[model samples]
Target: MSEATADVRDAQLAERKRVAAATVDTHRDALIALSHRIHENPELGFEEHQASAWAAEYLQNEGFAVELGVGKLPTAFRAELRTGPAGGPTIAILAEYDALAGLGHACGHNVICTSALGAAVAAARALDGLPARIVCIGTPAEETGGGKIILIENGLFDDVDAAMMVHPGTEHLMVRGALACITLTVRFHGKSAHAAGAPERGVNALDALVTMYNSIGLLRQHVKDDVRIHGIFTKAGDAPNVVPHLTEAVYYVRARSHTYVREVLEKVVACADAGARATGCTMEYRTDRMYRERRNNHAMAALYQQNLESFGEHASQPPTHGGVGSSDIGNVSLVCPTIHPYVAMAPLGTAGHSPEFREAARGEAGDRALVLAAKCMAMTVVDLAADPSRLAAAKAEFAAAQQAEAAE
Candidate 1:
């Protein structure tokens, strides 16, 4: 690049940094308040009307053109801001605000939503002379249905060049990938009768459930180390004196990749079927509408890592063995360049979905994560906007990974 062009780019970067730094205090307070509000309200997936509306309104106030109800989901929306020429690359900042069942913000989604919002606002204000389009997509139902998968199917991310989101975990760093997973419900039905009077005439559905659980436990030893099969009995016998007529369970089957997840899910279903056959009870199983697996976008992840480093934070190195849980964002990686990095909000070993993590979501540590995540995300957006080669590289990596997965 010519010296003149380099100088201009440097000037733009400096100006963006200045604007971001100047507004940090104001944005910080807004983010903290937003996080607390969402944490207190805590709605479940696909039903986060208040969370979605508040995010849209906040961005609209910050000069973004907000579009409510992007897909069939009532709580899903998109906010867009454009700068410079129209031909610039479009970078997407993803926001998720859904809460866990019964735990409110235990998974720290409250932090994720506010952080993404703060980042987008900073990006919008700083992109005065940059050649890029900024888009903040409000995706619902990360805890239940894969909202991003639905949005992708609806062609929401078709034209977007790259996407990024930060998740609050036990540590502050990027997660290279997440496990692919499928949720399923299994039901068994049998004839009910008085246990002491006509035990022979009644088929016990609870026995079928116990048999299924045992079968899965035995099957686990044969699967790959990366695979996980876990379930909970949602329904069982009501009273010991009566033979239960019906029973049900919910299961989550996970694998390192989509193909493996599909394979393991089939085996799990077979186990459930065997249990039903052994117990002489009719059984039915249904998989949830969405399935997602691990997503490792190295190029985009590295870019975000570098941006984080620029703000005095370092990305965590991948472990030599073992992997984290699954996420719907895994599905998004299959379609486009995407990064789901982890920003530390709680201390190490503070597990997600627990009461401790939920408490941490509102404390000082959570507030720090919110600010750091926002800065890193905003800076990464600037990086993507200022450099075209990086975007090309990210897209190339994404295509290669998708092709490799398809071939496998």
Candidate 2:
């Protein structure tokens, strides 16, 4: 381009950096407060009313046009900010704030939500003359209902060019993929009779449950090493003198991919069926909608890695072997250019969903993760907005990956 144009671009970038630096303290305080507030009032799954409202209000006050209750979920929301000329790419920043049932913010969703909000705000303030649309999506029920999958089905991500979100983990790293999973519930029914009157007249449902558990334990040896099957007896016999008439269990089946998960699920279900047959009881099973494994966009991930490196943090290398956990964000990656990098909240090797990790999530390390993740995400957005070729590369990579997955 012309010298004048180059000079103008340089000036714009300088201003963007200035704005980013100036607003860091302000955004940091807001993020810290947001994290604490959500942590204190921990709401489960799709019931994050107060957390959702807080995010919506924060974005609305910062000039985004906010819409609440998107995708038939009370806690879901969408906030948009447009800049420069129209017809530009729309980039989405997703925030998840749902807590675990009894563990509260043990999964560090409070950190995830605040970091995303901070990233959006930083990007908005640094846009300068870039032509782009910023959308902050408040997705609830990620802990249970898979909110993003429902939102995707409802066309919320249809207009977006790319999406991004960060997860807090024990180490800072870009995960290449996650296992696909399915949730299931199993029930057993049998005839009930008074124990004192006649033990032979009653069929024991508890026996069926025990048999099923043993069957699954034996089936594990034949399954793939990467596959995981776990369950809990939700219901068992009520009283000692009464012949139990019903028993129930909730199970989760996971595999390296969605196709493999289906295969593993069928085998597990057959085991349960065998239990029912052997115990002379009726069996019923239901599988919740399957969750697809994550497909990370390498191009996007690399960009974020570069930004993190600039801040003196080393981006983690992808694993050479073994599999990680599953996430609903995996579903979103199937349809859009996405990044689900992990920001360190605890020390390396610290496991998630435990009391130790939960304690670390609210400490100094977690706070650092909040700031670093926000900065990395915001800088990546800047790179995308200023470099057309990078955006094109991201989209091209996403398309190729989708095509490969379809062929498989």
Candidate 3:
């Protein structure tokens, strides 16, 4: 803690930062090409064959050991870059490339995966003379399926020292806390009959669905602002003249934490039950994978912010009031010290999952942001590789946060 020691450490970091930035510039062409290729293809999660293959091939070309079809997911992959020694600290940078069903790369995952790839490669080439292992994982199906959750359960991250990824968003941020979420499939069953001849002879399931939807609208006023409930009607009736025999809807219930999500979902389901009973129909519901809230590691975020600022791009604070969605990275944060930061790829206030955002994911601004993100993440990895205490501090922060949440 002496002044002389601190000065030496600062000088060492400055040199590493220079090397990191230069290395990212060296690989700019390949990184930009990869990002655009993924954006143009726009494959959905769990079915990203071309995207996954290109990513693995790129890493393989860069001399990293690659493993495809990781964690039993056909499109998932794991690539590694080892330097100086065999058993050094390992830093894993996550990559998400799957696009939305109809919107293509509207969520900017194209920039996400390529930036992670660029970061891993840049960090490996930093010439800091540090012993470390860089891991880039191609995490598929993050849009719907919990790809990272499955990978963690399969022991993919069991040996990782820290995990990080830069998401493409409207603004640069260390991390925006995500809400816990659950997807529900609700079905209403009723008897069918001819509407014109004998409308009263059969129960109308559409009525039940409409009633339940209205009930949810009213229920939203009673819950906390952190709670978000929304859904769409998937089925109502085959024709206007015939009484609908079945109706279906899919709803997503989200809250600040898992407990609150379940608490709100229980009441939401009750509304459906009442609607079905009043309409003489039967209601049934099922849920998909539940996503947990993300926990950001303070020390780790600070390091990333500092590294980003070193590149002259200021990392801004996220909006305080808004409905934040969920991510599979939340599950990884629960098990390890992880960071899901954001690097701005479009103008401020650009809405995610929109056409504007989709274009930005491959435009000039996105390419610039990708290079910046790579430099920042690689510089941060340099800090972790050269200094063991950086990893320990991140882990300690994560452990403390997890413990506090558990105690609550």
Candidate 4:
């Protein structure tokens, strides 16, 4: 492209970004109301019926073609708005609405989902003959169910050019990685007998569970630094006096990479098998869907950070080590160019999934973060839609990352 034409295109893109930011400001009140409403009504994974419906309704009102129960998930939905004709590049803005058990909105998903809604509507309004399609996907059950992972299997992201979402955190960060994770449930069955009178005839299932737990504790020492294995006893025993016939436990295994996590998971399960063999108790186990590690597209993240800084909200230096968790968005990232940045919502050091974080999600800081994140994300979408070169760079980066993973 000629320098003068490039300059003109840049100017046009700047104007669209301004319009998108203004559009976000225009819907500030409605967006806040939606965030507050979802905050007030706390729902668990796969059960965010009210939250999902409210989000879908709002998008429908904004002229997005809304579809509820997407990917065969009851609380999942997809809303689409095309700024131009068909065959244009598609950008997906993902929304997660599941609340933590016992603690409501502690993860600031209220901000996550509402910000996405605002960004989609604002971007759609700002586009001027841009050949792009903006899609807002209501991904439910981030707290438990792997909704995005299922969506990927359902081919929801097959046509997507890029995906972006902002999570509410203690500080703004353009790149935060998540561990790949999987859940395991184990049950042990043994013969019940009187503890005091006929203890010899009884096979203690609790002993087997305890043996497995201890074995895992030892296994943890041999694993990599990023590997995390934790579990809780759901059914240890009915009573302390009686010989327990059944015991069950649930565990979460996580690692920096999916392949390594699977390798570690096998070792962890072998411990359980050893426990069963040693205690003469029959054992059975099952694992839930895997949540892949995040692949943050640096090209896209730089654009998001640039847009975020334009609002005078600079992101903190990216963390070098330690602070990481798993999310289903990682699965989406593996399929297309994706960025999951963080917008500050609470003071630094405030623990996520806690009561303090829950309150912050509905407080003034939370509201500010929601609006600002929406504006930033909307402007970032403008960057992708207006400049083909920017999108090309992001796609190139994503392709390289995929190729590297495949070679590994």
lDDT of each: 0.85, 0.86, 0.89, 0.93
- Which digits, one per residue and each the tens of the lDDT, describe model 2 over residues 228-302? 899999999898888889999999999888999999888888888987998899999999877888888889999
lDDT of 3 at 335: 84
**Per-residue CA lDDT of candidate 1, range 1-408, in tens?**
999998998787767766765565578988899899999999999999999999999999998999999977789999998877777988888999999888899999888898889988888777776668899999999988889889988988898888889988877667565788888899999889999999999999999999999999999989999887888999998999899989999999888777788888888889889889998999999987556765667887887787777777766776666657777888777777888889977888888899999999989988988888888888777777776777888889888878887887
- Range of the 10 consecutive residues with the lowest summed lDDT in candidate 2: 16-25
Off by over 4 Å in 4: none
Q: lDDT of model 3 at residue 75? A: 96
Arranged by lDDT, best first = 4, 3, 2, 1
Please give, for residues 51-159, the per-residue lDDT of candidate 3 as tens digits. 9999999889988999999999999999988877667788999999999988999999988898898888888887335678889999999998988888988899998
Q: Whose TM-score is higher: candidate 2's or candidate 4's?
A: 4
TM-score of each: 0.93, 0.93, 0.94, 0.98
TM-score of 1: 0.93
**For model 2, which pairs clash?**
none
Model 4, position 301: C-alpha lDDT score: 93
Give candidates' CA RMSD values in order: 2.0, 2.3, 1.9, 1.0
Candidate 4: Cα lDDT at 133: 94
- Quote the lDDT for 336 in model 1: 76
Of the two candidates 2 and 4, the one with more favorable lDDT, higher being better, is 4
TM-score of the candidate numbered 2? 0.93
List the lowest-lDDT window of 10 residues for candidate 3: 122-131
